[model samples]
Target chain A: MTTDDPSFSPPSFVPFERLCLIGLGLIGSSLGHATRRAGAAREIIGVDRHQPNGQKALEIGFIDTLAPDLETAVTGADLVILATPVGAFDAIGKAIGPHLSPGAIVSDVGSVKGVALDVLTPHLPAHIHLLPAHPVAGTENSGPEAGFASLFDGRWSILTPPEGSDPDALSRLTAFWEQLGATVEIMTAAHHDLVLAITSHIPHLIAYNIVGTAADLETVTKSEVIKFSAGGFRDFTRIAASDPDMWRDIFLSNKDAVLEMLGRFSEDLSVLQRAIRDGDGATLHDLFSRTRAIRREIIEAGQDAAAADFGRRPPSRADDSKF
Target chain B: MTTDDPSFSPPSFVPFERLCLIGLGLIGSSLGHATRRAGAAREIIGVDRHQPNGQKALEIGFIDTLAPDLETAVTGADLVILATPVGAFDAIGKAIGPHLSPGAIVSDVGSVKGVALDVLTPHLPAHIHLLPAHPVAGTENSGPEAGFASLFDGRWSILTPPEGSDPDALSRLTAFWEQLGATVEIMTAAHHDLVLAITSHIPHLIAYNIVGTAADLETVTKSEVIKFSAGGFRDFTRIAASDPDMWRDIFLSNKDAVLEMLGRFSEDLSVLQRAIRDGDGATLHDLFSRTRAIRREIIEAGQDAAAADFGRRPPSRADDSKF
Candidate 1:
């Protein structure tokens, strides 16, 4: 659907009467900017326990109004988003459930969907709708100030609606994302969690681990690590710079899946280490070749899939030259 | 130390009568091109065991002449650079030893200096001078065809010269790199190897290990690894994409230092893994905060140092938002 068509011109904005966004961190602030830009709501109010962050978000125009109390923010809101850290879900859900408007939809931007749904659903009001959502777009930078208006553009916004949900509301929510330049995808909460356990969750945990490992090398001077990082430590340093609280919650929430993946990664590493120890260059070469091919495949598929599209032309990994 | 006075520049256009480059890989080719562009060489000759790389270097204008035999390249050259893989230094030095010219300055671009000196010095003619060098700039990409003009811009090129070496030859080589837009630093061969083992060599080995580990995971599908790699794995892919031959030689030649560093790294990693298993959030947070401070320090130093200089900028760790 081209935006040039009169029908595709978004006839009119389907505005939520009141949208309560919890947390004033990077994701929440970006969502506040995105919703306002898409004109998806009449009033965008933010709820946070941190008084300074709530005040900062309002001052920076991330939200139209700031509410210090979570229950008060959800009192009459049509759409309530729990954008806090994944570990904070249960406490926030219990506090806001009783005050949610009838027929209002509650969603979240937590990374682990199955855990988020589990923590959120049991405490929610029976009259309200619980739709767990996760937008797979972020940087190491955090806080309200670190966010920008275009953070979600061309990225994946995964919605995991529980079975037997209202179809019309789902369609409306999907359309809302499409209008904001993000491609929306629907998946089961359990499947989404599993896929991300391999993709986003475990990778981040490993990155964090390696970075921690590099930081702990007391025998090697820190200056040396920074200087010749061109070899590989530079890459880990980037990941290690990720928002600490967000990643902390992710590992805590997806503990089982993360531990399982970590075990596999460790096993694979031991084999490679043994091959290197035994001077088996062929084994290392073969694995490197296979992984290089996989990198090429990813650059292609990511451009085709509406999810996490980097926009513009494809960046074939062919330009990757490791001297 | 600045190129501010164009009038006081070194004597212009002293083209070498004969210049021999032992390896036609990325660094050697870039030096060839820069030498040609600066009119510093009248005849640029390259030699490689594999005839194809030497031929490619000639075809790409990186070298004016090609030598299928190492002796043919070394016979009449005043400046002979052994730019082959570090592991191949012994074989190349033995092959070219008897053919060296009377006052030839034999230098190299190997990453590890101690190993290079160990292999090359014994085979060198007494009259021939040995100046071990390493250009600390490279991409993940390699080969003769991958060379570019600006690759050495703003990069550090360290020269590890032996005690009581010919001052005139050393001054000429330093002038050579300065003309190529690199800041030249002089240091001892052992110190250079130790510094690089911590910086370049260890980092490359770690990246290769982690990337190989992630790729060999049987439980997590390859497709999932590719999809979520935008989070942090992309950086690993870039680092892991470096030339296998170069890295293979790096580890083989610098075995002792790399093994020592690897021991340090593994010990540190075990401590971190224990902390994570014990759920020491405070410990994790403290480490994260310290790493952040280190990153800032590197940036500040680079920024401050390069403020007055023309081409010696910091590494690109700060460029990407994902990092």
Candidate 2:
């Protein structure tokens, strides 16, 4: 997946004969669309607790069929992806384990890999190959209609397979994600959780907390917050507007790493607070200047959009401009 | 500027004969380009202590002429806009006070209105009108060349004029910003600081702090942080990459309001931290859901671009796609 691999080509591998997706929200539906686009799955069956979402997924061509029950969905599936909230993985694993065919590969798109391993590994059948994966890409949108085939393009898909898993099953899962346009990385479940806590979980917690603080301010009315949000606050709102249920499950499931990161953030914030209190312009300027290099590195690594103001349309593009 | 106004027209007010900008950074250069585009200034004179910045401003036609000293710049100017960092306002005001022409209007484009008023008011002559203005618009990019004429289009420009200020001067300043395509709102300096403290200052502080924390993590290397930033941290980097000098002054100048907002933010964060530690999913879910409505209002009010993913071009646009 690195740029240095000039001889690289998309791997040729057998596609899944029957792929069962347990949740048809943003990630699941997106996987459906991407797999369909890549011809990686012959039959995509969606099983969502919400009937409307399953129906919408079928109508939008995100799935070939919608199963009314978990048993029917996993009956003969070659691959089963648990895309529900991380908290539901234990129950879902228990329900689908008996129904899953022998040699079935079980995977997930959960944010908290360590918790997913803990909860799902105990409930799944030993004959099944459990592979926990996290696709490190998404929009702030959710539901079937929000899914897109290109959502995983150039993104990282991390696989945290259980210890001593079948090498054949791991290779197949890696190739599957590769076909979906994602570069694959393999790591331990605990490492994945810690990495994401700093990159995603803690960042989301801060955004949610800041928005709550602004909304509660008595001196600065809510109307003013919205009106002047372009200053900096609006960016936080976009991240904070993410799916609440999924995020809540993630924070709780990955509590220790998130707590550790939060402690570090609070300590750093105290230093900044002291700098402000003491009118230490040098300290503030030095810290602010140092962070710019990290932004450049992110852009250079192709991890973010490089355009100014997050690639927003200029005012001259009146048709697209909200104003 | 309300959407309901059917008979509205762009105001045609008396333009400045000589507009002297005391700094030629992002805001100053953008103002120069905008005023020139709108025919609001007959001659734009730029004064920058950095010689190269003044040269670039002249070369780029951001200013019609470059003044080597503050005295020469303010000698015959009808308008003097202090577009430097807020920390420099006091010294700039004192330096140019005696040379300012009679009946001249002295305004600024500082982020903190209260500090602008307090610092600039004491140095200006009795006959000159002092107007503290904040164009609530900017990108993270700075310098003379990193500006565009349309930067202020459809943005808000807040004015915090002192009591007993000349009515005509206020109207002229308002019309000037309106000509540059900003909607004008007048408020007390104190209120403006409080509103911006919540909307801008505190958000930047949090962004800067979090990025610093991530960079300092021993377990997570800086390369990993940069590689995986797309998860959520990338958005904060954009705001954190803002001009260090300008932000340092903003925090120091609006220390009281910013500290108040920061305190509230810390308290809210503690609540969220406890919820995560206790696995209080309901509390986290409820708070996350409420913030989405604020994002909707910001989009509906045209304060932000409405396109998904912050209006970044779709990946199919091969020229802009990093992958």
> What is the alpha-carbon interface RMSD for each candidate?
9.3, 3.5
Instruction: Please state the CAPRI-style docking class of candidate 2.
Output: medium
lDDT of 2 at A177: 92
Candidate 1 per-residue lDDT over residues B1-323, each given as its tens digit: 12222553344435567789988888888889878777776788898877888878878988888887888888899889887778788998899899999888899988888887888999998999898888777766678877776555555678888888876677677777767766566777877776677666666665566566666666556655664555556555666667777777776667677666666655655555565666666666666665555545434434112111111121122222221
What value does the interface RMSD of model 1 take? 9.3
DockQ of each candidate relative to the true complex: 0.21, 0.57
lDDT of 2 by residue, A232-286 (tens): 9989998988998899999999999999999999999999999999999999999
- Judged by lDDT against the true structure, how good is candidate 1? 0.70
Off by more than 4 A, model 2: A1-11, A313-323, B1-11, B313-323
Clash pairs, candidate 2, are none
Please provide TM-scores, in order, for all candidate models, with all chains considered together.
0.84, 0.95
Give the range of the ten consecutive residues with the poorest summed lDDT in model 1 chain B. B303-312
* Candidate lDDT (C-alpha), each: 0.70, 0.87
